[model samples]
Target: MYSALKAGFLALPYLSLGALAALDGHCPPLGPVLPAPTQPSKHEAVPAAAAALRGIIDQVTATYNGSAVAIGVKSIHESKLLFEYAHTPANKEKRGAQKVDSDTVFRLGSLTKVFPVLALLKLKDRGVRLDDPITKYVPELRGLKKQAREDSPVWVVDWDEVTLGALASHMAGIPSDLITDIAPFGNLSAYGYPPANTSRMLGCSGFFGTAPCNKTAVAFFEHYGQRPPAQVPFSSQTVYSNIAFPILSFAVEAITKRPFAEFVTNEIWKPSKMTRSFTTKPDDALGFIPPKDIWWDANLGFEGPEGGYFSTINDLHRFFDAILLNKLLPPAQTRKWLKPVTATSSTGLLIGQPWEIFRAENVTSDGRMIEIYTKTGDLIAYHSILVLIPDYDLVATMLLAGPEVSGSAMTLMLSRIIQTLLPAVEQAGKAEARAAYGGTYVDKATNSSITLSLSDDGPGFSISRYVIRGVDVPSTDPGSTLPPATPPRLDPPMRYRLYPATANSGRQTSWRAVGTRGTAAQVDKADAQIVWPMASCLTWAMMDRVTYNMGARDHFVFDVERGKVKGVEAVGYGVFMKKEC
Candidate 1:
């Protein structure tokens, strides 16, 4: 397996740092922060943050109507479990309910969607392309017929044009679900609805309390292949579809010649060390299965890839850790996999292959926002949330089970925890930065110096003073009107901010300083054309704008030994400076 993966994906074209820079506006490159070697790592044990979080958890669980709520948080890169909390309702406790813990298992619902994507990505080793059409694998879907919809005009859905990539990203324009859930078979007569308008969709699985609704790949194509297009294939509109992952799973089985569940267990679950996770419902009593719940035993059949998997908070943390640590796939593929494929209606939300990404604001002291990659799952009585903050190398998981459990309630609990946790994370990161990188650096031969310090008003280090060759670099601007390259002259000093550029991070850490200045348009125009002009607070537009000798004038490379900052090399000026403080 290692040889196959090395030959397949490791040889694929690498996504350069330039590709990541393209997402500068959405997710600013802050680079992954490493733990300090000499100092005790705050992420290893954030006692204050944990204590505050426990308070919030207790407050939430006090009013929680569910039988159990289990939450876990970890530092993905460090592989450290930061915090864990569990709660069981008092009434359920009196009735002898099982104790809830981080290891308590609960249904994963749509979070199972992410596993199919990972499976397909690994199948890339066998020459499977994401752009390959579904018909290429499942030939039964070749001659699909179009049907008319009651809401829209008759439109033919060209199934041949739909690619696996589109399906995974929610861009395939497929129906949300073939059966519309078990609502059609529900008791609509009690709600004054006529039986003529409602009927159970054959081959569509639900909580019907019948035998397992297992349908083969052929049956799925026969029932859903001819359905009318939800929209045009590959349109900009994102339509949530449970039908997509099943198709992906079918393609997986077709390509691997193995059952989807078996392949996932061998390739993903076992490898990630998710011991309690399962595609098929376990017959044991370990799971938090509420008594007399019909939906608990309802088999999802072919739809297992979409919303049928069960996992514990501990298992989910392990899975995310595996992804972040590059245990399952190569680092490049993992980075590419975690990114968004398309934008959604909301500015803060985005759609990945199977991830429902959200961008959080005001996460730091400087009011800088961080992008959080997340996937939410929901079933009849179980709800789950998986959060990945790549910026901080953090992962948080929440699993809830019981009749009173809800998606909104779970979301609220997670939000409160994050709101409390981020401040502590930011404080710790700042402390580490100050200890390692914050101080004055001097070149004794040239009598040049640069002082860097952390500020409460910004995200990265601020250059308080910079002197190079007896010329104040921060207070001088290279005259653009000069015939060619010339020495910078005196001008008003501009504050330069330093941010981590991860692409250059390995043996030596790379950081880029962003200098803000009025753009040509902003300087010429008297009236502002936009509410927030480019010069207000957008640092991305100003980065790398001033280059000298084919290198960024503001780029700095640090020499770190065992997580201790020894010195820095000014790339553009080609000068070495030793730490003075």
Candidate 2:
């Protein structure tokens, strides 16, 4: 049932924008939003937020007894790292264990899933379509026959029906692995299975714990694709399959006629200046290896596409920053690629192109839900998480490694940091907003003015008063001199709130005022509640409905100088309102 809802939601035009801004229309009643900050401070929240996060890291590391931990907080808006933390066990120097820092390398298990999708996207200009089936490139997969079972009709996945996009998004219905519970260096004879007569048992059954498999990309796909599917393709079910990513790499290899490693290193890592990242394990002197597992280095021949890469905090930061800033792909494609492709049964959880998105509710003073996009990677000894909060242009990265540190440590640290940092960021954002945009602007030449201010309980700046050439913009004029027999010329009251628009250039930004009017039967808190056809979400009906001379009446363009507002242009009226006391 939820699958159907997801499908319908995906069908909507501009869903990426709509889903992110779904709550923007729900404005706080005039006086009850967030309490406006009295003064805007410079990085006022960074030191305290960093301290709180460091405390969390200390607690988690002590509890888990981890050998190394690194955390980074960065702001994409300012292109700066707000805070960074690095830690190692106290007695490390006694035994000569290398200390960890932002540049230290750590294995990024399934977080490597993003690379295949990015490679495919880069090859889009080469006539590679994500909707193309796997069989189109590697035709050998078509020869895999389904098992004949008396009770089962569908015994294996129909590779013909699966597309690259579905695989990247975890909607391809592939099983997680080819061999279940088969260790890299273990014997199946103890489990009651007969000893193999050939080397197939030793070579074919090996997984992450064992040496790299000797199979080629095509052979690996043929071996894995013959298994029974976890769900039907495009069923909107998210079954995380590590093998799915390798299949995508197979597509990339077939298209480019080059090895996946070479392509990724040259195109992605090198271009983004990710110096410490590697598809294979780097030297011990270069990487931070735990004491007990110091000699643990296994090559992932086929699994390299999924859990085979190693990266550092600095490299990963550069990677995400480049992608988010549209330095890698075009802006339109980047925006579309970063959104959720399906929703899970959990109301707060959604799935993107392998992204585990969480909707954090009530994190801010205004009680606005913030959407956080995250990708977590867990391996034998290392656990890492990369979190992107698109709303505020913030990112939180956590990486941990040790025998005692489990994947839960990453989760704990991520949750704690988000809890501590978001509120601080929200406060900082509000303070900055108030300082830059909260004030009165007047056109001295024409005696026109608008008073905009932030409230303790509002989502945006509220227009308390607006005037244009002696005409009240928000008041009901209704042409008082109209003929008596004409229509009553009723004009309903409008409450205005100004929000930042998507159009931004260098030092200028565009803000639009959205006015909400009382309906015939209005329920203030139930604005999202709907009967049928979603009647309550008709905010579009009231916006830009009345335009003059191709300029929207609600449009206000702010000219910024050094991150502070200089003046606001009322585009509809062709007037510039200079900032004044």
Candidate 3:
């Protein structure tokens, strides 16, 4: 969610008018609902509440080689400003002095998918069903088939399952390789390459390349349209690829009959009064001139539906405000956007339409459950974080420009800041509960698993499991006594450290697991069978069966029935589960 922070002249020297002006066109004005303070306070004094956060930013900037940073937060409850800050390097670059402020815009990278989601909802509002097939809108997909062989012609394959919903939710089963390219439009041999070599390179370049050049996308579809069906499943990467966005952009354009950027500006940005937001042109007033730096040129341009746009923190806060207020999209649609579409094990975060759903800890004044909606962006040399606390009506966004910023590192930093700052707003009054539920649990009936392990010898979490499938087994001679069972050789466990949730409370959970070592090569030779512990398996079994009590904070209870874990209830946080060896 975006925050609304108007640029105002302050008395402090550090808070100069130039800095304020730098923020003017970048920061959005406070929403109408925000209550004005009876008296304005000094802006220079660092609040004790945000001290830890400031320190964190300083440390991250120093560690990551960042040249500039900007941060903003807003309270969804009252639409009031929670905090905002911008910092720049003491040394300047040659082209122009890099000055960061609330208004300074940065390429949002993959965050562009959120806008397409909004567009999809808008289409839905106009009586378009997500279940409708792509062919329904773009007839080109009709009769489209994959080639059986390299020299074969395309043959039709059923695509009834490739629905609009699947495309938006990333279940459309479209291969990442299907993108078309629209680049190197002039002479083919301009780069001193043979015409044949240039043609060959162009044909295969679709599978590679950093950005989704339009020319490449077209070339890919032309040559591979007759190839075998796409095999990759829906994933976060699918949402970020240039291939996915052009198709989505085409759909939006076809539906609205307007340029994608223009439609977004009128339909979402302007109406929401996100004055600083733009998907097409960079804001010159905020110094977001194109081609000013290599990073900027490489990152920003014709905004794609997947991840091409720029905005200030305040503008993003406004965008979030629109979501919470049910202004841009209906409440039901917004909920759909935030709902978990799939489970992501790699990060242990639930994947929503375009958002990542995190079950946060340390929420309410009295410990209670809270949900976090988050998304991160990584471009050439920039990293950004956007997180929303639904229960607390809080939104936080950070953008850093540098040569070495990474999404993972930025997220780690953001998580730390939120954990430290959340308490000041409203403390989650739950006591430090017992650490009884700290160990791993397993369930044999469901054949599922989980493992909970600590990090830095400190409290943390990770997930470890093997997905079992039915397979043929060799039969042993009846007379042959089973060879003496031998214990399976184990390997050193691999650890996945958990980030504590930023919400008030619900499940303060974490995970860990053992790495694949001797399992693959020794499976056939091993005699003794490996099995997961009951508690861990039970948790996995109950995932879909149990009705989780978002309000319940009781002792860690694992309900097992018929040899499978049917339910789990844990106080403070859930126990970690590990897969059987």
Candidate 4:
């Protein structure tokens, strides 16, 4: 009986092993298990500035009815954490209350363009010049066509000669989408049509069955047999990034023989030691995928070259450090990335290769001058700002994610925050200006020469200007400021000169002025002219709020003694300036 029982036990073991084998074939292994990622240390104390930022984030979240929001700010000079806050609601039932932490990732949206620029710079380091024609890399963009109208002839253009520089600077002249004339199929999903938006099209494996988006990009190269037309003046309307991203991605893949995402991870994230940064889907639970609730279904899965990546604020700071330090690309290349390539007058800002350039003016606590380099980012449900005071080695980044907000509102909020935290920033700048210049001066206008006196007014300073020639001018008439019947044309012998009222103030000098020959009747009588005394006359006027940083010498270089002004830069309607003494 004992021998029989042992035999049964042995058979039972075999039977169980057989069943396990069957289950293995049906279920398969769970694949390689990646260990949980280490979280960043949280020992650092939150800065007081973070409190103010948290309040803003709180307000914005409540106002927008957003689910969750995260913010991160760091001082680049000290590499110190200024502020980091993530908030979500306690009740899962409430859409806006889900809590978030530093590790929580969020879709960078259009911020994905930064990676492509880095990738291109990487290739440039490998003997590829940005000025090289598109044909040099992708031969498919030969003969590109544009539909003129419903029944109109199609306009074809050669895109081969378009250079990488043009693409990077957004001067490539490509439209936002291929189909521009006809209204896009609005109800794509309802009409049984695939989501053909740029994001969806780029993410799909086979787009519209006509060609893979990547192939379509390549085909664009093949069809446009020659170079694009010669360069024209840089205009915002002339630059488009939708066509640039895929083309650049294709180039990186072609040259490196690696996926664009992988190339970025190895070249950018790894070297920067950005532990929390990722290009592909991350394994950690904290890993954030774009909120699919906003648009596409989450089950479908979506990824694209334009805006399909996730990252943390901390990781982004690390990335910025790499770019600033010239660790990923050489110094020259890094300089190229930060250098302003195109001028965006619409914003009264300059567009650099990767940075948007602007002038910030600030009064210091001690009444000094403060100028700084400022860059900002706007994405779906997120807003970011990066200001670098190179002289002070100071850099600040502000990131907010919740509900959509207008770009202007975000910029205004950032300006307010800077104002509250760094009141001394502008004061120091003003003091610097005082030391630079404090003296009386003279200036000339088209019809008359004006003498101005600058004296230390007890409370602050005062300036006065009087017309030395021409007819007496009324002080209060609205139409008195208008120029004569025939406007003075800018030509030889009839020149306009700007004289500085104060070295520190952006206002021009009183000694120089617009000059024109006028009939005696139109000229103002010397005694009849009224003199207006004001502390300082406005020279360069920008309607938008100005941000200033005291630490950086070049922050507001344009407003500085020798900064360049391509033309009279202005912001918003009715905001302007005339050369006044």
The worst-scoring run of ten residues by lDDT in candidate 1 lies at 13-22
Clashes of each: 1, 9, 53, 56
| Candidate 3 TM-score over all chains jointly | 0.58
Candidate 2 residue lDDT tens string, 1-581: 54564445334322111212223444332221332232212457856877777787777677544468888878776555677888876533233337778988888878888899999989989988888998888776655543322223256677789899899889988677653335434567887877554423335433455556544543354355445678988886678888888878888999999999899999998878889899887876667677656323756677678877888888989999889878888899898888889978888898988788988666665665567899889877778888898777777787777777778867866788878876777777777787778889999789899988867555678888888876676654222122235333235545567877767794888877765544323433343554443234433443453355788677889998887789898887788998885
Which sequence of candidate numbers ranks them by lDDT, best first? 1, 2, 3, 4
User: How much lDDT does each candidate structure score?
Assistant: 0.71, 0.70, 0.49, 0.44
> Candidate 1, residues 1-581: lDDT per residue as tens digits?
43563344223321111121112211234444333222223544366878988987887678765457888877764555778898866444232237778877788889999988899999988999899998899876655452233334244556688899999999988777764444446677787766643322563465576444455443365556446778877788888888799889989999999999999999998999989898888744667765445556778777788999988998999999889879999999999998999987888899999998887665655555567888999987888889988777778999887776789988888788778886677667777778888999999898788998865455577778788877787656452222235554434445456777765465688888765433334332412443533223333443554456877677899997776788888887777789975
Candidate 2 achieves a global lDDT of 0.70
Give the per-residue Cα lDDT of candidate 1 at 412: 82
Give a tens-digit lDDT track for model 4, residues 1-581.
54563344333311121111111111111110111111111212223444565676677656544444455545443364555666553322222224566666655545666777778778864688777776677765543443222221224334564677777667766544331211232455765766555522223222222223334443333322222332332445545454466677777777788887788888888998878765544553553222433311111112245555667767877877777778888876675576667766454366665456664434222222233555555444455555654433345555455434545766776665565444332233234333333222222332332222222211122223322234322221111123446433322121111222222344432221212222222222321242632111111221112222322111111122353221121111111223232
Model 4 global lDDT (CA atoms, 0 to 1): 0.44
Model 4: weakest 10-residue lDDT segment is: 31-40
Per-residue lDDT tens digits for candidate 3, residues 13-57, read 111111111011111111111111211111222145577677767
Q: Point to the candidate with the largest lDDT.
A: 1
- Candidate 2: give the clashing pairs: 32-457, 33-456, 33-457, 33-458, 34-456, 34-457, 34-458, 35-456, 184-210
Please list the residue runs of candidate 2 whose C-alpha ends up more than 4 Å from where it truly belongs after superposition.
1-41, 77-80, 90-97, 146-153, 179-209, 217-222, 294-296, 444-447, 475-493, 517-545, 561-564, 572-575
Task: Kindly report which residue stretches of model 1 are placed more than 4 angstroms away from their true locations once superposed.
Answer: 1-45, 91-97, 146-153, 181-200, 217-219, 479-491, 517-528, 531-542
Model 1 TM-score is 0.86
